[model samples]
Target chain A: MFDFFIHVASIACLYGVLALSLNLQAGFTGLVNFGLIALFGCGTYGAALASGMGWHPLLGLPAGIAMAALLGLFYARLGRKLSSDYWGIATLSIAEIIRISITNEQALTGGAQGISGLPLLFAGLKPYDGMARLALYVVVLALVWLFCQRLVKSAFGLSMKLMREEPQLARSLGYDLDRIRRVVMLVSSAIAAFAGFLYAHYLTFVGPDQLVSPETFLIWSMVIIGGVANNRGVIAGAFLMQFAMAYVPFIKDALELPTDFVAAARLIIVGGGLLAFLLWRPKGLFPEKVGGSNGR
Target chain B: MIEAKDIRAGYGDGADILTGISLSADRREIVTILGPNGCGKSTLLKTIAGYVRPRAGSITFGGTDVTAVPIHEKVRHHKVGYVPQTDNVFGTLTVAENILLGARQLAKTEKEKRFAALMDQYPALAGKKTRKASALSGGERQILSLARALIAGPEILLLDEPSAGLSPLMMHEVFDAIGAIRDSEGMCILMVEQNAFEALGIADRAYVLSLGQVAMTAKASDLLEDPAMRKLYLGGEVHAE
Candidate 1:
């Protein structure tokens, strides 16, 4: 029971990083990125390739971040001409294209069977490796939370919110809208990629199935339920929803429900959660403080 | 001072909305642009403001050729202030944030000083410093927008319908405030307006457009007294029904 809870905590912390990344782009920058999983995939594939190449395990970090940043720049370029809704569709399509490409690249990515048996990140810790991994994720989540909080409170953050709410006004005020989008996409993608690196290492596997549209929507549910623009709200959201998801199997077992119920629960959690919050709490669990930057 | 010569502009391969429009406004005066809907009043203002580049003319601000400069460059380098007709204030920003959005380049002391002075100038916004702009009334939003432009201490102010969608009393008050800016600050204010009588009342000069062409240009007083002009553009079914 103790080990199971630790495993769940580690996964939850991993998701907290992803939720923070998505909220920073979609909530504050009005990016509406629907291909978050693809950015995460960049990290996973980076690590998997590094492991397969017999490179140093730590080398994967920068490799993964670089690929994600390049994809981020591509996404930002798409945004310069496309409106938010169209840009969302474009991102979703790009993610699908990437997944398909990886699936067909049998020699490079081991086809759909995937690459596994990745070395653990903290082999040096030995007997306490699991706990060490969880601790590292927790520390990472804290750092990301602090970083996001600091970002949103700064003048640049104000410019981001301005771009989100009133983009034309932001441009009129001398902000390079395209440049802001690029920076936000780059940072958010790098963060999402970091989560992917952790996920790949901890699970010892990389597969296209993990980079699906639904996984991105799951993160959206977390952001919607936690808070849209609030950094702490997203982290809290990630943990709560991740635990809810992690416990679904237990619910199935306790209720003696069919195995398919586990799959159905994902749809319910994402779609129903989004609908409920958008209807009742449009701003999410913790709406940004009423007085704008002054409240912070 | 701002001047445009024979400006022709449109958007995204569309028909030229502004054709051969020439106008100028100098310091200590308010120049009003008036026309019927689809006659390109807003387009003309936008062209001069650099939101739309003129295809066949030149724009000079304080003796610099700024025709190709974008709106942001014109604003940051040339000290231009613009207020759109509607949805002008940043709803999510606090009143103070909205006012200070463009003054990021100002010195800290100067920014704060101007902010305090603006608050005193617009007492309706003074009490709502920390309040989000979304909560303000329409008239207050208009005033807040004006205050935002004024805080920059602009050399040229471009206003698109300062009294748009306001009660007659509020309209009069907005025009009075604009007129005060010209009289006191000697700022060259060029505005596009639909409320012909009120706009002309405060403006020193007026340019009337018809079908993207300059239909007339005259002193505001002369245009106001021209009965045929009021009937054709401001009164009767042409404007009312």
Candidate 2:
């Protein structure tokens, strides 16, 4: 039971990092970055390509972040002419393009077979034992959480929120919209890339399938259902969603339900929850910043 | 000092809203543009602020031709401070943050100093420093907008219909604030206002615009006391001088 709990906790931490990164762009900036999966995929591919060539896994982490940032710059440049639903479409198209490229780039990404035998994060530490792995993962989670908390409270974060709420007002106040959007996109993508590195190393495997649209949809749902603008809410939503996915087998087996029915039931629960949240609380559980209330 | 010579500007290739509109404001002077609705008063202010480019002629400030300077560049150089009519303050940002953002181009130390000075000048804003701009009343928002623009320490302040949609009491307060700013800072102030009588009373000089053209220009007191001017433009009624 302890081992199971630790494994669940570790996965939750990974997803929490992913959701937090997405929140930076979507929640604060009101940028519908559907191409988030592209950044995540870039990180995974960057790490896999670097480590597959026998480089240090730690070195691969920064490489992943750099690759993701570059992609974010590209997105920022393209996203300038688009807004509202058009922006969403543009980003979604970009994500699809990234996925297709990964699938076609057999030499670089190993195509469908994916990459394996990737180096562990800390070679000196034993990760086969569940508790040790869980501890290390928690450490990573804590670091990311602290960094995100500080980032959302900084001046840049305030600028992003202002831009999100009213771009015209932001412009009048001397905010260069293009510059702010690009920087925010780069930073958010880099954070997401870092989370990707963690996932790659955690699984000891990386694949193109992991960077597809379904994963993007899952992350968006997690952010929306958890709370759009709340950092802590994203973490909670990610954990809840991951826990549901992970524990479905136990629920199914204990209830003597068929595998297909269990899969359908899980989807129904997640879908219903997401719909209810959106219909009832469009701003999510924690609304954006309120007057005089420092978001804690 | 600022000058707009025969400036023609509009939303697009349509009838020029500000047709051959020439005006000037000297340092330590209040120049008010008074006109009826649909006149080009606000457009004139926007053109001067670099928010709208004049289709013809030049806008010279401090003896430099800044007719083509972008809005952000103009703001960075402190050449112009614009207080838009509505929704000028960023609703999501705190009043303090909004003021800080206005002075973003200044040095960090200078920005801090200006922020402190503004807080001292506008005591009503002090208690609301940490409050979101959206939570402020309309009058407070207007004051915050003016404060934000002033924090940039602009050489020329462009105010667009500051008295629009305000209670009479609020209008008095806003005009009082403007008077204090002009008296203390000695900055060049250009304002577009629908409240013709009140604007002329506060202005050092007043320009009357009709159909995007300057109809008359004179001292504010003379315009306010002119029976013919009052009968023709001031709501078709002549008050005893």
Please name the candidate that would achieve the greatest TM-score relative to the true structure.
1
Listed models, DockQ each:
0.59, 0.34
lDDT per residue for candidate 2 within B1-241, as digits (tens), equals 8888999999866888998989899988999998778888888888888778889989988888989876666777655788888877777668897777787678989989999999999999999998888899888999999999999888888899898889988888999999888999999999999888878878899999999999999999998888888887776463554
lDDT of 1 by residue, A1-296 (tens): 78888899999999999999998999888899999999999999889989999999877889999999999999999997799999999999999999999998898898788899888878788778889999999999999988888888887887788788777776677777888899999999999999999999999999999998899999999998999988888888888898888899999999999999998996788788899999999888887663365324
* Each model's Cα RMSD: 2.3, 4.0
For each predicted model, how many residue pairs clash, with residues at least 3 apart or on different chains?
0, 0
The candidate 1 chain A region of ten consecutive residues with least summed lDDT is A287-296
TM-score of chain B of 1: 0.96
Most DockQ-accurate candidate: 1
Off by over 4 Å in 2: A1-4, A51-59, A112-117, A120-130, A262-266, A282-296, B5-23, B33-44, B52-58, B90-135, B205-241
Candidate 1 docking band: medium
TM-score of each: 0.95, 0.83
Report how closely model 2 matches the true complex, as a DockQ value.
0.34
